[model samples]
Target: MIVRTIRADDYPGLNRLHASVGWPQRSPDGWRWLADNPARREIGAPEGWVLVDAADRPCAMLGNLIQRFVLDGRSLYGATGFSIIVPPQHKGASRPLIQAFLDQPGVFAHYTLNANARSASLYGRLGLRPWPEQTHALKLSWTIDPLACLHGRLLRRAYGRVSAEAAETMGERLMNRRLWRPGPLRLPHGVVDIRDVSDSSPYGRFWGTLSEQGALIADRGAEMMRWRLADPDLPRRPLLLGRVEDGRLTGTALAMTAKTSIIDPPSLEIIDLQGLPGFDAIPLLARTLIRNARGLGAAKVRLQALTPDLLSRLGDLARSARREGGWGHGHAAFSDEAVAASWSPTPLDGDYLMCNRPVPPAAERQWARRRAQASRASKA
Candidate 1:
């Protein structure tokens, strides 16, 4: 087998690699963005590296998400990996591919968010340690549709017992509602659905300050934000609730629907929450998300891996669901432990595909057509 830089023409082989592992096909545009996007090349990093067999057939592929990072007052680059796959017959192909990602020059850090638990020993040996516990250790969640929550659980016969107990003892919605009563927001104009993320807008201005905090963080400026919002595999657009004042963002929250497996219930997730320190609009966005979750008919809303400051501002808004330990491992190549611990990791900080279950664009289009036909029939 020979390892080489991934080329734009490798999309088909990569899809085949994913299919061999029982995973669904990824979006063509999305795959191109990872392995052939201008962002990767502009940073002077390989698009990605691939391992091919003797017949020139690609057997394994590991894609890269390389981006600029600011750490301890120094401007540098960081690399986070995505779409790593190797068939059983190929055996031990993961280490070399991962090493190739880390081996690049001018990189300050190398981390991954979707690595499996079985890779813990291997990752440890590769010098990629677990990320801080501030976000990864605990998960907090809120229930928007208690009936639907209880209903889906009952079908799974798994987490349903807890819901059944809550139903019997506390009554549905009582515990969640009493924790915090969030009212509609209006800081001079209430919260607005962030319709524009142009660099001159408040959304872009907000990330500008965050990136300069002089800590370990992914590029969150307009360019990357725009790329994420245009996710080719996203089922729909994510909701961004913002409170702006005098052309600056005071606070904002972004919510998206994600599922790791087909068996998982539809989840409305709060993935990014930060703004002018001490801004009080988090609960307002939380309220809006819960309201929206109901509108979308989602079962449960989740708060995943937010920074400590962002998490604290919510203040008992959601119950602690479970502990999510160590899906990430990396060490800072330039900065120290203090800088590494400061990174506010959301799914946004890593591959968007980490939490997203890719639904082929064709399938999505077909579903839209069916909905339109149903609407026409109803009018008739």
Candidate 2:
């Protein structure tokens, strides 16, 4: 077996590997963006790594998205692992594939979301200690109908198009009627306005203020905002809402709606929320997001609290919201134990939202064709 950095020519092989493992093939445009984007390359090179057998055919691959972060008044680097693919025949090859990336220089740390129990165990043996902070996904609404929710759950189990459609319709009607109206947003004196804006809109001053405060945070400047929000493959175009006081930007939040299955109602998720230190703006932002999501037909609103201060404020408003924890581990190169412990990562830090996008019609057709071909190939 051989492991090497991915090259431009390896795009086809990578896609083939992904398909062979029953994953969707990325659009050509999306692949090129990942491979050639200057913003991504500015942090590191060669995308990620691929493992091949003696014949030079890829058996497994691991892709990384390196991101710049600020910690302890200094710049730090981190990477989020995504699209990890390994066929059943080469299941044992997974550990070595990840080990190769961890061995690379400047990698500091790596994180992933929703890893299986098996993978979690493997990561533990590699000396990555789980961060102690709890990553919560809170639901903002409490008006779901028991009957409709039960009906949708059963329909999902039946797994038919007609049943699925019925479930969604029922959910929509139930949620739309039960919507709870929050009080108007009350900003402190001198706070002028809050409204939605495009990702490319200027807010450098707002971000600079947050960065200067020295909390461990990923860079959320214009470059990252444009790259992440404008990606062609994003499931939904995130709402970039900001708070302005006296004509200067003070805070911003990115929210989007998602529904994974017929049984699940659409959820509004706050992927990133930031404001100046000591600024009591997140609560008002949360209220506005809940109202907007309700109007947009989402059944619930969710967000992760990245700091103790934000968590405390949100806890008061979303008292009935469900909470859960997330797991992560890292190495010293990324940051010292203290810095790593202080780091707070939201769902946006991983590829969670990216993977939730709706499949394009063309891609769906292509997937059906590929499945048919595979079925025939197996029988032959």
Candidate 3:
């Protein structure tokens, strides 16, 4: 077998490979974001690399997602692996594929999120290790809608005794007994307002301000924010909320809509939460997130890999994944020890933010039409 860079043509075969192992694959357009991304182009990183058999069919593959960050006033480049696969028949191809990814230059660090047991061991052998902080291994969750969060997990056991509908009714009544409305608190001053991505003017100089205080932070400037949200294949269109006070954004967050998996109901996953230091904007930001999530019919609001300061600001609803156990784990390898020590990894740092949701059928056709028009204009 020969190794080669991934191309647009390999999407179908890649999908086939995904199916062979019960993993979800994306449509051709869905796969385009990896290669067509402005960050990848600027950094000169390949979309991915694949090992092809003698017949020129891909047997194994490893995709690289590039990201840019700022650390202590210096810029840093990083790559995260995605959709890495090596079929059981081609066991030997695994290390080679991973090595190929590791060989990529101009990267200050490499990481992967939510690695399974098998993959974790493989990645460990190749020099990647989980984050040093115990917090990065914890999946801190906050229930936005108690009734919904209880349905499949806590309330399911009572189903054989009482009907699901009856159980739900009882749950609602139990919740109603307490006046737990955070509306008045989150808006103690009513200064916070909800705005669409078009009205993201407050974020104009947000990144510069943030990098001054934070040693390691993912780049989320105005243009980068627009690009990140513009990915056509993203599961749900993430809600970008900002805490606007005194005519500028005091705090902001990206609430990603998670359609959900087998046991849990749908939820609003907070990818990253940022706030200016002076006053605590997190509560206000959290309140806004919960309100919007409730309006959108989400069961819970979950945030993973929280920094210590951020975790402390999250008042109440602070529970681990299963009330005790954890489902979050971070794998990383950084060249600079000081940078690694200073790093407070958030969910935004890896491809998990983009691929967490189950892959749905591609429907964002406008991106294609727009690209075609641009192409035509360029040729003309």
Q: Residue 354, candidate 2: how far off, in angstroms?
A: 3.2
Between candidates 1 and 2, the TM-score winner: 1
State TM-scores per candidate.
Answer: 0.76, 0.73, 0.76
**lDDT tens string, model 1, 1-380?**
97888876787898788666545565778666555444566777877789998877788988777766666556556677877887778779988998887787766668765455566567678877655444544556776667756655564574322332242332222112211222333333567888788998878878777666655766666776677677665656777788766666777777766543333455667767666565677776776677666555456777655557656777666444433444443222333455565666665666643335532233334445666887999999
Candidates in order: C-alpha RMSD to true structure? 8.3, 8.7, 11.6
Candidate 3 residue spans exceeding 4 A from truth: 19-24, 91-93, 144-200, 260-264, 315-328, 358-380
* Position 344, candidate 3: lDDT: 66
lDDT of 3 by residue, 1-380 (tens): 88888988889998888666545567677788657766788878888889998988888998888888887777788888887778778887878888888889988788876565567677778898766456646666667777666674654454433433353333221111011221222444534444443423557665667778866777777666777786776654666666767767777777765544323456667787787778567777776776666655566777766656666776553433333225336677878777767766667877766666632332124334555787999999
Candidate 2's displacement at residue 242, Å, is 1.0
Q: How displaced is residue 351 in candidate 3, in Å?
A: 1.0
lDDT top scorer: 3
Q: How many residue pairs clash in each candidate?
A: 2, 2, 0
- The better candidate by lDDT, 1 or 2, is 1
Lowest-sum lDDT 10-residue window in model 1: 171-180
- Residue-level lDDT tens digits of model 2 in 291-323: 566565565666633445566756567666554
